[model samples]
Structure formats: C-alpha cells, structure tokens
Target: MGFKKDFILLTKPYYCVNILLSLSYLLAKKAPGICVYLFTPKESECELDGRETEILFFLAIVVMIRTRKTGSVTMINYLTSSFIYTKIANLILWAYADYLYGVIFGVVFIITALVIPEPTYSGPEHVTYFRTEHALDDELESDKRIVWIIAFYTVWNPACVNFAPIFSELSAEYNLKNFRFGKVDVGRFPATGKKYHVSDSSLSRQLPTIILFKNGKEFLRRPCVDVKGKLQTFFFSKDNIKAAFILNTLYKESKENGITTDEKKQK
Candidate 1:
C-alpha cells in the first residue's frame, strides 16, 4: 500500500515540488516546515497549473518514445524524476517569469537531456560468467538444462560496453534468478570465439554477438547466418535484441519449467 501510494504520487508535480524544496531547505540548514508554503500564496491554490501542464506535455513525449520498453521500475522512475526536475527548473527560471522564456528553456532542457548520461543502475542481475570453453559447455549441458541467452563479447569492443547495462537490466527482469544470461569473454578465450563463429579481431563485425541456447543446444543467434553462409546485418538495440531473442517467450518458459535455481551447483 505504501509503495502504491508513492507510485501514484510520482505522477503528481505539486507534491513533488513541495518535497524537493523542503529537502533543499533542509540541506541548507533551514527549517523545511516553511518550504511547504512554496507556490502557495493562498492555502487553497492547489490546482493543476499551466507550469505543470507544460512539463507533463513534454513528459508525455519522452514516455511515448520509450513505449517499447518494459520492466525496470528504476528506469521509469529515474526518467520521470529527472525530466520533471529539469522541467520544474525550466518553469521557475523562465516559464513562470515570462512566456517566451518558458518555450526556449523547455526546448534547451530536452535537447541537453538527450546527450547527457542516463541514471546509473545498481539492481538485480542473473548473469553467469564462464572462464573457459570447457566450463561454458558443462553448464549448458548440465542436468538442469534450461534456456541460456548468452552474450559473446570482447573487452576491447566499445559496443559491448554500451550494451552491458542493457543486458544487465534485461537479466534483472527476465532472467528471474534462472542464470538465463551468460557472458563469455571471447577476448580471453579466442578458441571459444571460433567455436561460436564469433570473431574477436578489431575489424570484425561480430564483436558482440548474442546467442540463445535452449534444450542443451544452440537455438537462435542474432546477425543470423543465411543458408548460403553469409552473416546478415543486425542492429543491437534493446528492442531488436528483445524481438530477435523472443525474451518474452523465454521468460515464460522459465516460469513454466519451475526453474528455482540458476545452476545445478546452487541446487
């Protein structure tokens, strides 16, 4: 019930402003009790104002762009808070002061956010790392055989570093304590790279390849090979990975199989 209330309150800007100001007051060694009176010259002036409407409109645009994203309440909350906070600052410094200032400030903030680093995530994870090819093989063919969505990556690849967070967040949600995520450092084990047909060289197109293993065998791999043995191009975006891997189906199968542990050793 407490979580639900807080969740609903997340969408309310008036309360958010009050809390923010109160925290700021406390930080500055001032009494926060007085901060509640902010933007409230009259006690009953608590209605959805033009400032909030403006902020919410832009917020709607941000949300719409991420419609395909599922799971990760942390991602949702961080985005909501950051965008609202930026808009609130924009409203105070420009919008409320002058009509034209508001328009310019709003656009600037949105553009700036697009380039800045997003919030850091330190949440759930169920990824397994294999040191050698032998270790990786044993786990995949183990008695408690289940789905394994493995990421074959090299440390030197910039694309793999960028994809790390996306992979971790996905594991936090869909992996569900099942060790569904596996990582193989093809940089360290080049033989493993050849075994999986992933190349680790600097100019290689398959630096960070995602493969799905099921029923103790390889099931699907992105940048899927054609019948003629040519590798097709694949975009490694989060949406593309989800769709190509059919994460939703894999997640469902994990539940149906009653996978209570990540590995046989854990059992």
Candidate 2:
C-alpha cells in the first residue's frame, strides 16, 4: 500500500505533463500556421509574424513543467518515499519531454498493479500520531480493534511540552493490541480541537486534553477539574494516569483479549 501511494505520487508529474502537453497541442492546432511558423524562422513572412505568441507558448510550457516537478517532489517528500527512488524517478521524468496517451495508460496500469489498502500499525511500543484531522477521523471510523487514546495538544503550551515525554513513556509501557496512543497538535489542526471541544479560547484551559475513544465514539477525558473550572494539574502524571485509566480499563481489555504485559515483554 505504501508502495502504491509512492508510485502514484511519483508519477503525478508525468500526468500533469501529459495534460499540459494535450492543452498545448490543442492550442497549437487552433493556430497551426502561427505556432509552426514561430518554430521555423524561415517562415517569418507569414501574416502572424509576431514573436509574442511563440514566447508565450515557450513560457507556458516551462512554467507547467517547473510547477509539476515542484509539486511531485514536495508530495514524495511528504509521503517519506525512499530518497534513492525519488532521485532516480525525478531524473527519468525530468529527461522525458514528450507525452502520449499510450504512456499515460501505461502509468495507470502500473499504479493499479501496485495499489493496496494501507496496513495497520502492529508494533507494541510506538504510537502512531496523526498530522491531519481527516486522517484521524478516517482511522477512528474504520478501525475497531483498539481503544484510541488521543492527546490533543499545542506546541506553544508549556504544560503540553512538559507532558509530551510522559505521554511517550506511557505509550511505550502500556501499548497493546486493544489499546493504542495517538496525538494531534491543536495548533496545526484547530478544526480537530473544535470538533473535540478542546480549544475554544485563545488561551485554552484544555490545551493538553486527552480523550479516550472506542468504536469511533469518545468515552472519557483527562485533566479532571473543579466547579470553578480550574484544571487539576497534579492528576496529569504518568503513574496517576496509569492508575486512573490504563489499569482500570485498558488492562482489563487487554486481559480479556488474552494479551498480557508479560507476553509483550517476552516479545
């Protein structure tokens, strides 16, 4: 599945090049005499002798190629494809100057051959954090194997910064097939914060909110506060969190599923 996504991303430049080439061909067909004449200096005696048309076509092609290459490279990097593959693919595509429907069909065939659904993370130690709201939503909606414990945080908050390492340590200690940990930066995804009712104010009280979800619905949250709405900062510690949540719920679920911490340690 990763390979398929990389393949599609890698060939995007070629797709863009094909579309641009087709558009240019259509435009040239519309004014064949002017376009062909521009390429041939000897045909300068033609009525449409203006060099502006030729220069515009040249500039358009250059801009199209440059923009497509930039976009493709950016996407490949974002998806974290192999550096060697990226270099080789970019070199080949950069050398390619012509486009054809047959070549486009070939690309489509290759993509279809490689395409597969993304696999779930099966590791027991590390948590898989999400960068976008869409991805987080999709994962929650589609996967029901695990109870998701998502930390909604912002980088600018000192409390959140302090809690990051603690969260990582907890994830390493308590990770199981039935319980998983994730995090989203509210600063990067304000919509996600809003959807979860965490970051409504500029100085959000719940800057480092932690929510537990099962079967796509939220069941619990952290930073238990008082009637005056002041956060209980002391309860955010690793040992406290484990006693309150992990031991009571996640541990029970893992045991019911026949997975023990002893088994994890042995692995």
Best by TM-score: 1
lDDT of 1 by residue, 80-161 (tens): 4344444554455445645775676566556545654343445677788999777778987674467788899987665565
> How well does candidate 1 score on lDDT at residue 184?
96
TM-score of every prediction relative to native: 0.52, 0.46
lDDT tens digits, residues 239-267, model 2? 66677575556767664775455755655
**lDDT score, residue 77, model 1?**
39
Model 1 Cα RMSD, 1 decimal: 11.4
What lDDT would candidate 2 get against the real structure?
A: 0.58
Whole-model lDDT, candidate 1?
0.64
Pairs that collide in candidate 2 are none
Model 1 spans with C-alpha error above 4 angstroms:
1-121, 177-179, 261-267
Clashing pairs in 1: none
Off by over 4 Å in 2: 1-125, 200-202, 224-234, 258-267
197 in model 1: Cα distance from truth in Å? 1.1
